[model samples]
Target: MEGMAITRTDMLSVADTVAREKSIDREHVLEAMEQAIQKAGRSKYGHEHDIRATIDRRTGEISLARYIEVVDEIENEVTQMTLGEALSEKPDAKVGDFIVDELPPIEFGRIAAQTAKQVIVQKVREAERERQYEEFKDRVGEIVNGVVKRVEFGNVTLDLGRAEAVLRRDEIIPREHFKRGDRVRAYIYDVRREQRGPQIFLSRTHPQFMAKLFAQEVPEIYDGVIEIKKVARDPGSRAKIGVISQDSSIDPVGACVGMRGSRVQAVVTELQGEKIDIIPWSPEDATFTVNALAPAEVSKIVMDEESGKMEVVVPDDQLSLAIGRRGQNVRLASILTGWDIDIMTEEEESQKRQAEFNERSERFMEALDVDDVIARLLVTEGFTSVEEVGYVPVDELASIEGFDESVAEELRARARTFLETEAERLDTRRKELGVEDALAGLAGLTPAMLVALGEAEVKSIDDFADLAADELTDKEDGILKSFPIGEQEASDLIMDARVAAGWFSQEELDAMRAEAAAAAEAEAAEAAAEAAAAEGAEEA
Candidate 1:
């Protein structure tokens, strides 16, 4: 029987070969083989018995054993043994010791051999997948070249030597086609380990793909002399890259463009003739945005820093060029700069300015009962609203180019009268609309806003407190109609309404108010700090 026993030297050699071929650890292969053998051992013995197998690494000798746990009393006869029975095998057997019964080597049957082979194959495949995932997980965002294994429904599966990657249809460049055995290069955007295997996702249309191509073509970018700040792509149509140079002597845009545009042309050729814009980056958003809209000269840029928006003015002839066909140029610029860009012609800007002037002048004339010349002066002095004229320091109003103290006084008086009359009219309407007086008393809730809330069935302080900030301030449709209020203002109003409705105790409301005041102070301090930093940067 011992002479007929099989030696596992061949098994060890097979594990080594499989580990080498699959690029997995030799121990993983051996452990998988041990599990397979242990399963077979259990089947040959009894399913109720506790069977385990271990392979000697040096000799490839497999040892099969049945383990029984020593206990004071045996509950499971198959796995647990009484101390008396355990001590019969070993004199000093303890309660926790496992009594091992060495068993003869398993003889492989036809069905058992096939089952072991299946388990080994399954485990090796899993180990291969894990190895693939570990190898490629850190390699994401890198450009990889592979041969197309298959093309199924416009999706290409690339054979990446050891692993496979899927280039989805939407991730492929527009109109780009590949067939079996064709070489393809793509950016590894994602790598996910799934039950079947590691799924490597490739993309040719990602904005980073364009950036990586430039990094390959341009030595400066690869070596970090020129850093890519941002990238925006419209697939194969066009792309924009924002780059900044560390060395003052080197031109970032020129470095990326290369000699005679060779570097950019190489990238463009790979992208199926996609146009590339290499713009010099600036810390100043206005300068960066202007640079992003290259070739189309910008006459002026009016930026609203708070809104992250810029109104770019170009010459009338350059308007179409700045906007591009179907607004692709400006759209790409917006994406590149991370700002909302509104492009307008110089003529259009002038007309808009004139229209704003007329509107302000007319507002002042009506609100202050002033003549056209006085209204124009007030508008030119940056007073757009009667509220500003009414509440501003009298000395500030008098300091306007054409206004004296008496004129300022009279203008302010008229502005005050207009506001008082308007407020009285709105208050009367609010009363008629059945708005509660307590709701009107809430700060930031104007008579008009209260009337609008009343019309929306939010007539009480309770109703007002129950409304969300957006429910009152949403631009499209809200209780306040087209009235635009900031989130902080809405929050403050809601808290005041809640307090007025006796939703919280006075002490609780005071604590809440204190918290809000502290938040406001912190926010104001943050804003001031940012403003000072920006001013310092500007000065520097």
Candidate 2:
């Protein structure tokens, strides 16, 4: 019986043991013990009694009592008492003060002891889970090594010493197999605390995983002398890494490749023989893109900044290498460079140029009433449109190798006549369709575009404003129907139409947003003040 009696010191020792074993706070364990004691006290006393327990942190003293709050009026006899009754017990008792009645210690029986143990175990488990969540939540994006604990339905569960993580099937490299007890290295991409436990999701196929592997092998990269600008991978097959050296003396690519390719080979072996292309990054987009499609020579690159696309012209023999097996090289390059790439051989480019030249020549001959030879000469001079010929200074046109001042003047006069005739024709058609003058004044909208809008019943500025940008410029189906326009032009035109329609100006919208922000700040201040007042009253 003496051995079975649990002393107050034993209670604190047990809490310390549980806290140490579960990796939870000792105070949390003590609080759980206090709750268990209060439950037992309530069971021994009347179930309706408001019993509470507190453990002294320094001395491990257990105190049990029934607490009644002193109020202006008695509400429930079990938990609340009038100020008069509270004053009888304590002469200086006031409203809002607690009146406590001490209770005797509880002797735990078999069932009571089991209940307390269960409560402590539950609380310790909850605290452990919280600790795990907090520990790993910020550790996301770190590389972790673990033993494969189990494999279920293609998903691998890794036991990472203190925590367990899941490597989902899709996140695993394609065709890569893992079995129980096998070691695995993965990147912690996400950590979510769910109802059951913390879900630490890991991935080996993520691009960052390869980046981390390189960082591990390359001391220069790890030391911040070399920066990994971007990484793109077709997991288990091929990858492209863009690196830039901050120090001119260090070669970022050489550092990552290591001696005799040992460093990159180590990464490749881990990735199941995936081929890696190390590209020297450049701030110049064209140079960077050319380097990204390595082992394939690029003859010329035409970039369209607004469209986020690049046209790469390679020699006919190098076309296959540039495109890669199933377009993998260019695909990875596009991902690394953030540009859509269109590959073409020199022959194809020449053919396209000739076709464009013929088209321009025919248009010049028809519009300017010139002979085929003269039109071809104009086309060869890089004049693609009549508008360019009309707008360019006569001296610039005369600078063309075969042209004189007289010929340049004749071409300019003919271009102006053709443009004026075309404008008159389009203006007559626009008037026939009742196109609004304001719509005609908007930039990027041709006279023909205005007629198309009028024909589609979008004549008024309000009507144009009501139309979506896609409806105005989408290639396949738009209000312009067959006329193609870029998305940026469409957006600009739509905004212009909106402004013309007397919608809110940019400055007005900014002022309104500022006003709303001020109101929200005031409301939050009021809420904080109220919360502080409520806390003060509770303390009183």
Residue 251 CA error for candidate 1 (Å)?
Answer: 2.3
lDDT of 2 by residue, 1-540 (tens): 221535779889989998988788999899899888788778879778899989888888888999989999777888998988888899999998998999887778777777777887777778888999999999998999999999999999999988899999999999899988999999999999899889999999999999999989998877777889999999999999999998899988999999999999999999999999999999999999999989999999988886677999999999999999999999999999999899999999899878989999999999989999989988887787899998899899899887889988998999999999999999999988888888888777899788888888888888888888788766566877565566757876776677778896867656765898899999999999986886577456
> Which pairs clash in model 1?
none
Q: After superposition, how far is residue 131 of candidate 1 from its true place, in Å?
A: 0.9
Q: For model 1, how does the per-residue alpha-carbon lDDT over 1-540 read when each residue is reduced to its tens digit?
A: 222445678878998999999999999999999998898899989889999999999999999999999988878988998989888899999999999999988888877887788899999988889999999999999999999999999999999999999999999998899999999999999999887899999999999998898889999887777889999999989888999987899999888888898888899999999988888889999899889998899989998765466999999999989999899999999999998899999889999999999999998888887789999988888887888999899999999887899988998899999999999999998899898887888777777777788788888889888988888766577666456576667877887777788888768978978998999999999999986886577456
Clashes of each: 0, 0
- Give the Cα lDDT of each candidate: 0.89, 0.89
Q: Judge candidate 1 at residue 361 and give its lDDT.
A: 96
**Global local distance difference test of model 2:** 0.89
Tell me the lDDT of model 2 at 253.
Answer: 91
Displacement of the residue 219 alpha carbon in candidate 2, Å: 1.7
Following a full C-alpha superposition, what root-mean-square deviation does model 1 have from the true structure? 6.7
